[model samples]
Target: MKVQYFAETDTLYIEFQDLKIVETKDLDENTALDLDANGRVCAITVEHASERTDVHRLTVEGIAA
Candidate 1:
């Protein structure tokens, strides 16, 4: 998994899988979900992320090895 914040675009992208995105579904004007061919979510993109999320802070927990 990976998380990236693009300062120039104020966009936040979180990738759960390194899979080819077959389709993009808009959750709203500022949010979108990327799916693979099997229809499983591969990633999520948030526009205007600075306004909607706390981009300065990130925390991860309960990750299993």
Candidate 2:
């Protein structure tokens, strides 16, 4: 998994895998979810990231198998 924050656009993108995104769902105007071909989540994109989320802090636990 990886996360990237775009300071200029105030956007944050969190990717779970490098798979091709087959579908996209909007959780809200500023948040969206991306899914892979099998309908599994592949990534998330948040707009207005600074105001909507704390981009400065991140915690990662044990790796997924």
Candidate 3:
């Protein structure tokens, strides 16, 4: 998993899997989810990320095998 934040667009993208997204589904005006061709979630994109999400800090838990 990975998370990316762009200062110019104020967009935050969180990738759940390493798959290429074939479709984007909008959850709302500022939130959208991405899906791969197999129907699994690929990532999530949030617009106006500076205002909508906390871009300054992030937390991750658990151990990667």
The candidate that achieves the highest lDDT relative to the unseen native structure: 1
**Which of 2 and 3 is the better model by lDDT?**
2
Better of 1 and 3 by TM-score: 1
lDDT of each: 0.98, 0.93, 0.92
- On residues 1-65, what C-alpha lDDT tens digit does candidate 3 reach at each position? 88999999999999999998899999999999999999999999999999987798888789598
Candidate 2 residue pairs that clash: none
Q: 1 in model 3: Cα distance from truth in Å?
A: 0.9
Candidate 2 displacement at residue 8 in angstroms = 0.6
Candidate 2 lDDT, 1-65, residue by residue in tens: 88999999999999988999999999999999999989999999999998988788888889778
* Candidates in order: C-alpha RMSD to true structure: 0.6, 1.5, 1.1
Q: Pick the candidate with the highest TM-score.
A: 1
TM-score per candidate, in order?
A: 0.96, 0.89, 0.88
The runs of at least 3 residues in candidate 3 whose Cα sits more than 4 Å from the true structure, single-residue gaps closed, are: none
TM-score of 2: 0.89
